[model samples]
Target: MYKILIVEDQEKIRNELGELLRRYGYEVVIIEEFENVLEDIKKAEAHLILLDINLPVYDGYYICKEIRQTLDTPIIIVTSRDSDMDELMSMNLGADDFVTKPYNTQILLARISVLLKRAYAGYQEVVQFNNFKINFSKGILINDGQEVELTKNEMKILACLTKDKGCIVSREDLVSYLWDSEWFVDDNTLTVNINRLRKKFESIGVENVIQTKRGQGYFIE
Candidate 1:
């Protein structure tokens, strides 16, 4: 199911929207924290966002800018501010769609479905974890808004782990997978690759990616 993050401050409206989306078979996440809306967005790891412009401290425009800097997660502005200027500003801030309040719930859901289809086409290629988006195709790791360059081997290792998330991946299995790619690398070199990957993740504010199991191989925790 697609995950939808609602950033509206109105309690009644937030719950209403959340329940409505839930009825449509979508996973809904509501942001209770207004101070660090950006942090909330990252943690949600949502496929799309429903934002209200009239927020407490920072408006939705600023929050939209923060999200645009790193993620391409589709955003739809949900506000009572209905004007060309408001819509234009939202577009400039990288909002994908804008819907005013008092709008039809069915219409809102339709718009969300359109944006999700355009952005994720059923599901996204990247895997989300701890605010990190790992794009196996590009061999890149995007954490928060920071981009971390990943080597081919590093991508392979991560791809393996993400494939079997929360499970142990034996070193011997990793070596076998690498060998199939005709990239012959010994255990020491594998360790070097893992360390390099960990450092890159740390550079992007992720201190740990892979964890050791002593006699066992490794697991991403």
Candidate 2:
């Protein structure tokens, strides 16, 4: 089943859209925090997204661009802003489709169906971020023209951080991922790996990408 993330802030619209999608046999994840909409979508591992333009912390255009940089998750702008500029901005930011608010249910569903097919059929192999192209399949991080090798653990850590790019990744979650991969290690080991990862980033002429969140976790700055 395809996962559909609803990033709309209006309670009624969000719920209604979710219900509509759910009825069509799509699993829906509703957004509860407008301030962290993009993070929520990433964590959900959603197949497609219905994003709103007028959000609390960041607008849809900003979120769209950020997601496009790292992921190719199909985004359909479901917003009340129907101006030409709004539509143009949505397209310019890499949105797959646009649906104006008070949308006709059928048209919305059709657009989503098309985008989902396109997305699942072909997805980006490299996640682009800050002049770096991270290739997970080959365990390589490329910057400019240089290629930096990453160990299995380092690759996993980088994957986790890049997956949650603009948001914090809790230490607990990172540890859990490692455990799930049958590579159990102490917290100290994770720290050492993180430091090494930072050094690799530095070698690539990048800095401050992996940020420590004090008692929380880590995030890409």
Candidate 3:
């Protein structure tokens, strides 16, 4: 099933949308913490998002911009604002579609279904080399049918390497991917994350899953 996230602060709207989407066989998550919208989005791992304009801490535009930096998931602005500028701004901020409030339930569901099918109809979830099962939507990793605890950095590194298995990822690229912004992170931090990932692999009986090239980079073989 495809996962969907609804980022509206109003309890009634959030619950109604979630229930409607769930009835259509979609795994839906409603955003509870408005202050940490981006973090909640990452945790939901949703294929598509229905975001509202007015929020408590930050507006939907800010969240959309932040999400675009790392993820390519579809975002549909579902707001009460029907102004042309509002629609244009959302599109400019990487929103895939826009729907104003008081929308017809059927039409909203149709838009959602079309976007979900277009984005994920044939896409398969990625599987790591060492029998580590990662549910990108839930941000959970499973090893031997049990959940494996991983730091956020570890998950990001593993996702990057496993997504490009057998390809050497340069240190610069790895650092950029992990940091996501122009923040300076020590080289030793990357090394630590890699070591932690190696231990996880070792725990699952997979030796040398991630190979290093002295001055080049690392790759999952």
Candidate 4:
């Protein structure tokens, strides 16, 4: 699922946009805090951002430029500012698209779909989970400034467990998933991989990321 972040200050509009995006099968993150908007954006790890120009502290233009300095995440300026300068400035500051308020719902959705496809086509996905940045394509788990690589089986195991956050994934189910991926692993081998995954996280100062529900299975809480 693609994560979309809404960086609008208005509560009503923010909630409305979140609901609109969620209804279309997109993971929506609504940013309410403007004090540290930049840090908040980074932590959200959104594939696309719906940014507003009129903000509390630093306006959207400044934030957009700063983000372009590092990230290539798709940014769509969804603001009430409908001036020629506003649109031009947004494009100049690395916004992928610009939409004025009172936008047609279908048009907005289409813009989001097209931009997400363009930005993430053949792109490696990275997601943030519990203080860890997981890059499934690269098979790497990063914490703070440290990173550890995972083997094929280990990566699959982590992916399975994290697919449903805070929920116990049965060992049988995990084995089946690995088998489907042609990894042919037994229960004992699964245990070994789980232990190895824990050790790798421990090596990066991340402990107990994967929790076991003894009689059931394993989970990340």
Candidate 5:
């Protein structure tokens, strides 16, 4: 799922936007504190940002400029400011799109879809871990001129684990991401797949990449 960070200060509108996005299957993150918004955005690792012009300390345009300095994350200016200058300024500061207040739900979703598709085209199909590179499209792990093929489940599991890098991913979450219906998949199935991934990595002289967090879950460092 794609994660979207909302930098709106109004309580009612923020909550409403979050609910709407969640209903449409997008992960929603709201920014409550504005003092360190830029730092928060950095930690969010969100695929996109929903920004409001009227904020607490720093306005959306300033924040947008700061973000553009370091991040390419798509930003959509959603504010009550409907003037042409407002939209033009947003665009000049590197915002991907602009939308006025009381936006049509369907239109906002469509814009988000288009921006996400355009922004993430050909993104993250291959990731590096340690000295090896894992290719998701080909389902192979390569290192030192040697290649090791991975099974469907193994590839999915590895991809999920590597998505957050050092974060511990719960077993239930992993199961949910791997299978359509978690009810039909058992814990042993995931354990078996993880074991297979470990063996595959070991075959290519990589070890201890996937670590278990006892009762919590697993993580790759």
Candidate 6:
């Protein structure tokens, strides 16, 4: 099931939407802590987000901007502000769709279903490996039927290796993929992350999937 994150402060509306989406077989998570909306979103690994414009600590626009920095997940602004400018601004800020308050639940459901279908309907059509599933849309890794939470660097490294499975990726290429043009990263930091990732793979019985090529670099078979 796809995961949806609801970032509305009103308990009634949030619960209502959550129940509506859950009925359609989507796993919905309503944000309870408004102070750390971005952190909650990252942890939830939501495929889409239902965001409200008017929030307590910070508005939805700020949250949307922050989310777009690292995540390309679809976002729909579900708010009371129903103006052309609001809709345009939301779209400009990376929101895929906008729905006003007191919306027809059926219409909302239809739009959500269409978006989900368009985005992820054919995602799981093929299984890659015995213990790994790739979410091409969200760039997430699933191991042994559970999502493997990876750090930013870990994901980048894994992505690079997965792209060239069985082919060796040099250390220099891995550093370039992770660091900026000017920034420098310590070699020890990369080793530590690789060790942690190996442990994560071991937990799912994919031990030594990432084989070190010693003098060359690393490869996944």
Listed per candidate, the RMSD to the true structure in angstroms reads 12.7, 14.9, 5.6, 14.0, 15.4, 5.9
Q: What is the TM-score of each candidate against the true structure?
A: 0.59, 0.55, 0.66, 0.59, 0.60, 0.69
lDDT for each residue of candidate 5 in 1-221, tens digit (9 for 90 to 100):
67789999999999999999999999899999988989998767677899999999999999999886545578999999999999999999989999998999999999999998775554367888878998765557998888876544566687788877799999999888776466656568788778878988889988888999999999998
lDDT of 3 by residue, 1-221 (tens): 57788899999989988888888888888888777778888767676889998998989899888876656577899999999999999999889899999999999999988886665443235455555676543445677776544444565677778776688998889888867443545667678678877887677556777899989999987
lDDT of 4: 0.82
Candidate 6 regions exceeding 4 Å error are 126-164, 167-219
Show model 4 residue runs off by greater than 4 Å.
123-221
Report residue 189 deviation for candidate 1 (angstroms): 27
Off by over 4 Å in 5: 124-221
Task: Write down the worst ten-residue block by lDDT for model 5.
Answer: 116-125
> Top lDDT: which candidate number?
5
Model 5: clashing residue pairs?
Answer: none
Q: lDDT score, residue 52, model 1? A: 96
Worst 10 residues of 4 by lDDT: 178-187
- C-alpha lDDT of all candidate models, in order: 0.79, 0.77, 0.77, 0.82, 0.84, 0.77
Off by over 4 Å in 2: 122-221
If the candidates were sorted by their TM-score against the true structure, best first, what order would they fall in? 6, 3, 5, 4, 1, 2
lDDT, candidate 4, at 83: 97
Candidate 6, residues 1-221: lDDT per residue as tens digits?
67789999999889988998888888888898887778888777677789999998989998888876655567889999999999999988878899998899999988887777755543333347646865554545677676665544565677778875689998878877665431435666567778877887777557678899989999988
Off by over 4 Å in 3: 121-142, 147-208, 212-218
Clashing pairs in 4: none
Better of 5 and 6 by lDDT: 5
